[model samples]
Target: MDLREKERKTVEILRALKKVNYPGYSRDIVSFGFLKKIEVYDDDRVFIDLEISTQKEEVIEQIKEKVQEEIGKIGWIKGLELSVREREIFRRQKIPIKGKTVAIYSTKGGVGKSSIATQLAYTFSVLGLKSSLLDLDVYGPSIPKMTGTQDSEPTSYDGQHIIPVEKEGVRIMSLGYMAKGDTPVIWRGPLVIKAFRTLIFSTHWPDTDVLVIDLPPGSGDIQLSLAQEVNIDGIVMVTTPQDIALEDVRRGISMYRKLEVPILGIVENMSWFTCDSCGKKHFIFGKGGGELLSKVYNMELLGQIPFDYELLELADRGKIYVLEKKNSEVAQAFLSIAKKIIDLLKISV
Candidate 1:
């Protein structure tokens, strides 16, 4: 390639990276201002330099993979080299809360993770331990709706620090409280992390024993970012009694384990249904997926919640299911799991 041709080729290669998005965001890496320089060599080879604010190793690899995939399609290129420099995004800070953080996480969605989290926090409160629930799922924060605090916005005494909204004796905070009903959060990964900083690092949570974080379903950027920034003391894997959910939970377990977060065990939601006439237990999703996962991973199965339609009704009315049905089987299951989590987290009431 001649000098002028090389310059044009360098521009082409650099422009090509616009298709390569950051690991878990819709925005391209080029727009993220990560592409520092590109050099097209005489032998139809190219070298690209990227400086990104993410410190995650897997994310770095993902960006490189995407860049290579996008740049490798050109027939004229003989080779491609990429270098990604991890720029420090921000200094690590404490969550400004005194508690053991227990995250309710899943690799799959719609398994009642938020319901369980809200119930768990209530259980802790019932057990006489001050509990706080931070609904960290910015995309679809269901805590406000479940707790019936959707209309109440958290008060920020200072512009930088927000005071959390309290409900059912459990201090609560979520982005859902501010947004209108079912409004989608259309933010990129960095914006999501910025929300985390504001909600977590900037919010003023009352002194409590347990902070239940209802994480959105997945092992993606949101999960990874929180794990990296906050000291997640334990994680409770939630899943339905099905192969697919168990499979997702398996991947979630691996991710948390890699992050060195303690696994508090698993909760099997919608495990079974009771026959009205025969009174026989019928496995709805599947029997013993939680138990099977426990045995396979050598992780304890915390509790299995039966298919409770009333619980759904309770949530829809913004009522705490455990408080409403304290004597119900599903309520007892939630309490059981909460007790196990308390013991696992070593939270003294």
Candidate 2:
């Protein structure tokens, strides 16, 4: 109602609006310099001017609707006027990466997707190829801890481009680096999407031959957002041998199929457990789930990784077992998967 109060509320509104991210773009409206001006009056009236780069009427309307929706949440605002202008210069720009990107996804959690992603990156490095791993699990980023860079944060120059942290001969980026120790990222969908985009496009990734992204389990906003933005080469679906896990994998495969992105193959993680005492293999989860899915979908069964306690121990210590225990069966399985992926993509490694 008062002048100062109105100004404060107007500023708050702008901040909130800045947090709204367009699905396909890598930056929010504010970061893209689309939100041009805002004015607040003492009579609880507000006006906003937005300039977007796209010529599509639907996109412009969507932006307006989102703005109005956000503003409507503040009941104190009595009246509002909004204007959106289109400028070709304001359009989203794609950041070119000189590498094939492979997203490792699962429809459900607790499938060791992150561990497999980290190991695959390490495997690529071991075979003398440039590799990078990006942790796009916005709510549960683990690449920082998995790669022994948990105490570090990515460095940015000129406050725009970020320098990725390197470890074990692989470049790494993760939201975990941005958070304080063990603090959960309590972000909404829009914020999560924006952060994912920033991590993918804003970071200064090296000339990697392959960039493996560890996506959070599920077919949620992150997966959809990624489909819209990046030209992903292929997807490597990870699942346990249990029927429950395989069911989720089917949904994941269907989602990618609808998106028209290639499903590189399926990796059957924890396919079995080997007894140390008797040297016997046991199908703990089930048998041939990966093979079943691969056959049904006509995709290759990249590798079958048996369950191993030593692999878990190395991962717990933020180490890549592929490098330390290169001779181990689990490590060898990862290498085989990596080679198959490289071959599928036709990348020289």
Residue-level lDDT of model 1, residues 1-349, one tens digit each, is 4567877887788778998888778999889887766756556767677878876989998888888887887779998766776874534455667878898988888988999999999989999989999998898888898998888889987787888898879999898877666667867778888887778876687587888899888987788887778788888888788886444665676566645568888888999998778989998788777887776566889999999888899899999888989998887888888888888778887
Task: Give the Å error, residue 306, model 2.
Answer: 0.8
Per-residue CA lDDT of model 2 for 1-349, tens digit only, reads 5557766987888877876777477667888888766766556667677878888998888888888888888888889878776763323334457878899988879888999999999999999999999999988888787777898778988799889898968989888888756777878888998998899888897588889999998998999778756788989988788875544665676566655578899898999998999999999889887887776556888999999988888888987889999998898899899989989999996
Q: Model 1 off-target regions past 4 Å? A: 1-93, 245-247
Q: In model 1, where is the ten-residue run with the lowest total lDDT?
A: 87-96
Lowest lDDT 10-mer window, candidate 2? 87-96
Clashes of each: 0, 0
Error of 2 at 164 (Å): 0.6
lDDT of 1: 0.82
CA-lDDT, candidates in order: 0.82, 0.82
Candidate 1 structure, TM-score to reference: 0.73
